[model samples]
Target: MELKKRIKLAYNVLANKSVITKDDQIRSMLDFLGIDQAETKGAVSEATYYACMKVLSESVGKLPLHLQQYTEKGGVRKAREHPLYNVCNSRPNKYMNATNLWGSCEYNRNHYGDGYILIDGAGINTKLWLLPSKNVEVWYDDRKILGDIPDIYYLYSYGGGILKLGSEEVIHVKGFDSLDGITGMSVKERLKNTVNSGIKSQNLINRMYDSGFTAKAVLQYTGDLSDENARKFTKGIEDYATGKLKNDGIKNIIPIPIGATLQPLNIKLTDNQFVELRQYSALQIASAFGIKPYQIGDYTKSSYSSAEAQQLSFYVETLLYIIKQYEEELTYKLLSEKEVAEGYHFKFNISVILRADFATQVKTLSTAVNSFLLTPNEARSKLDLGSVEGGDRLLGNGASIPVGLTGIQYMQNKNPKKGELHNAKK
Candidate 1:
């Protein structure tokens, strides 16, 4: 009942925002909701505070009826009879931790082993009912220790407990040291190795193309090429075929002779050969300038023989050289201008206000002051305050005043007429 009351109070406090104040109030509320005191309290070590928080957290969620049920059902014995009993009894192993025991058979069985049991006893008329399938059967000293008996006899007669069957229980026991020898390799490492090998093969093909091998050279290296590299090269060739190289000004290059020309050359350059020629030329130019080819426009063909087929190898190589030069020139320009510009600057002004009743009065006063200071020009103009200036003050009466002074000034014309004195005080 106390726990229920505390839970209700916590819910009410969370719903109604007006009752809470200070960090301690929040801590007390959390304590009443059964949150761990150590987790909520940080490093504060006052005995009374610790005791109060502990009692509150411990008492929270604990019902008298729950205790009575536990007592009537024999507490721990009833818990052992629960469906989760076999899962809890299984010892923790290297692959399976204590937390794994809490999950269903689907997740836990994958690593730990199949830990479920199914025993059918009910006939068709009664509908199927199952007793737990026993894995390991324990025999008493007096009973003949020969063959297996029904699990029911072990449960009812002998005090010896029976463990439900699992893969681990069925298989012969292997020690912890066995896992050490089973090399643990990751998917990422395998993928990386495959990619690196592809890159190397592509580099070799590029070298071959630069050495003046024709499109057929790519087919020769196709056996050595990885699936990933082949796919990439094929994609590059497709892009080349569709005139995408127009951006690099190689779309118009025609290597093959027209119909009028006699004995036209058959240039069957493969994807790898084209990549090789472009990369080789780019590298030569980049080497001359003491830079990496990727820093420039590295020519990438859509297909294996795209460079040779489209006759864009020379132009693409030249473009990469120009790109490298342009990048270097732009970088130099940026560095030269960096010293001329100034860094960022900012200004701040702080105002402090003090009041005895902080919660009720100070908050209101601070808000009003801030609102007045931040009011729009059109709104401030209605009060006849000409333009807002830093440190300028406005009196309750329609008067513009300077800051740091508290007085009203009046100017009088000095002249005595008839029976009136100009300097008379009201």
Candidate 2:
């Protein structure tokens, strides 16, 4: 009830200018819609959802994904231009691109505690469509867990129906859910109070600037002609004070009658107070959504080094969780039975986030070449350059040679050394 009142307050404050009705009428309109005013106050009003969505969406969606197969030497290499890779890269479906799909998944997961992708085919599940958590209900009976494919999902939106997919269809991607429910726990559900508080603070700021600024004053009209005239005079005073009767400073001075007195009211809210309150509330919202303050372009509590570290921490701590969830789900459900047995699986280019500055890249690549971990051509490939002649040969001065006798070692092994000959002759 208290939250509903706060939502009503926020709604009234935002909608104050749209209608001339009293506050009760506005509350009735909101209530008639069966909408909990605070329901949208979480993501729609608070900065938490926007900041989290921007970071998670662009980072997860824009960065490339790869389809990789194990190589002869047992090292996994990306199968570039693979059909599945092209599908995920260029288009996930007819309606949305890869960025939009992944961003929607991450956003829905954050808001609803679960994200789902519906695959239409049986093997090599490539055909994908995203579903809203609220619309798709997970249908799992006792035996549904042991089956290869997930249980049939009942989709409620767009003229509802049950989706009877074949085996290994309808991929389920969920975040951390301690109760082991079908969907993971939603961030909004847990942080309702914290989020609402931030929103209420914002609404408070809006209220302060919006209709809340009306100053109440005392006026003494000693020689009023009639009750009707006094009411008219009071209305004029309100219109003038609130700037409703604007005359572009032409009527700056008003000559009062014989004994009329009006003095302005003393308001308590100051400019600095709102600034400080808004900043403090922002930090609270940022923390609730696992976003750093600076990520949302709030740098008041951040420095260069700390902000950089916070970015890395966000990738490792926050983004990694969601990425891994996708990777595992796709690998398990998307791959064919033979492909899985043959070691074909899924992996995201997580190291893409580790791209360094120019100087750092040069230093790192040089070190990798010197250590023989990357051949010169491999290093060139990283820099988007073509391979040069003789760049394929691994060059290093380390004693850990490849397991084969060189010409020098074989010749020395065939004949006695000169030093041994000299000792024998002596």
Candidate 3:
């Protein structure tokens, strides 16, 4: 079946409130969409499922604006000539324009320099503004100061020449030079810092391993067994610990004695019992029964014989009891096989327009606006706006204006930053 048909069928089933497993639902959806079953026969990988969901979610949107903007050239021109342009150009009276006052006295009033003199065309003819009376020292914003001296000072764009004033003092100004070729102690210090970080990471891993608990002990405690079998399993463990089973590894020995009669042992549990079971580890359960967790596995395997079978049955019931107790802690629904199959079949109608196809669709609307039959806002509304794929709102068939553009208002809100959609979903 085609994927679309299969999805339709799945949607019908879901609408009827039928119970089905998650896997079944996915399978049905794929079948409806006409997706080949052979292409995805095994367990669904996380990546494939996520990709399919993403495509389905994004398939309803219109073509991006950049591609369609060319169709509305007249509207674009009108927007640039709009009265809002004059409002943006007007500047505040107090803030002086730096470009206009560069060589003027007004620049000295705004800047933190003493009287400035513009040297006109000496050797380079470049405008050299000087702060001679006061030695203008520049410090970085983050630089620390000790008394009147800054720890570090940066000189920017000093004229490359020497100037002598009267007979008393001379100032030497040199062009900026980079320290790229200069190697010093700072490089060595950086290398040491990197090595120290690696050592710290290794120490953290070692500490985690030291404090970790073993999985074997936990599993044993959680396993269920009859009283007699439990005792026998406990004894076997003790024997192994004491070197009694040194010659024969515990793997060769059956922890629960053979020929032990067993009966169904039902443990009634309340809501609180369920909650507490989730808190207990498998090791804790094994400790309670005085047996190893692996012994429970051995007991389960030995159930083929009539006597051992009885003990195994009791252990099986105990396992179910623990499971029931833990079920309360589950956060998601456990869909049945059928429900899952049907969920896979859920139908969603997705409208897709190729770049070329979308252009054609909006061409008529653009023509109408260019001819002045429609205003820019009116023409924009006629072009599908709500159909944007991957946007927050789902599009339904209607003539409603696109979000952020309604009535006579044409304010352009900033586009969301990259990765914002993914973050919003999370």
1-426 in candidate 2: lDDT tens per residue? 356776676676567533322334445556656566664534556765567667776788866777788876888877664557766666777899887888888778877777877775543346688876666555664466635654544443433334454335666777675476566777667766766766776676576566436657887878637988988888887666666545566234444556888876766656447567767766776676677777887877575474346668878767787788888788787776787777677777765676767677778888888888888998888877999999998877676544443334444455768885444445
Q: TM-score of the candidate numbered 3?
A: 0.13
Off by over 4 Å in 3: 1-52, 55-66, 69-426
Give per-residue CA lDDT, model 3, range 1-426, as digits (tens).
655676678786578455443445677777766776643453111222222222211321111111011122332221223222211122101243222222222122111212233332221222323343223333333443422433333232233533323211111121112143211122112233333333333344454355231112311444568999878776665454344664665433434335442232333335336424422332333333223333433343243445444434433443223222212111012212443343211111111222234566488656665554655555554455543333323333345544433432332434544565334334
Off by over 4 Å in 2: 1-42, 122-125, 143-154, 160-167, 211-235, 247-267, 270-277, 303-308, 398-426
Clashes of 1: 14
Residue 296, candidate 3: C-alpha displacement in angstroms: 39
Q: Estimate, for each residue in 47-162, the C-alpha lDDT of model 1 and write its tens digit.
A: 22223223222221121100001243333212333222222233223344323321322221211222222222111211111121123232332343332542222221112433
Model 2 sits at a Cα RMSD from the real structure of: 8.2
Off by over 4 Å in 1: 1-69, 72-96, 108-114, 117-146, 151-426
On a 0 to 100 scale, what is the lDDT of residue 129 in model 3?
38
In model 3, the number of clashes is: 44
Query: In what order do the candidates fall by lDDT, top score first?
Result: 2, 3, 1
Total residue pair clashes for candidate 2: 0
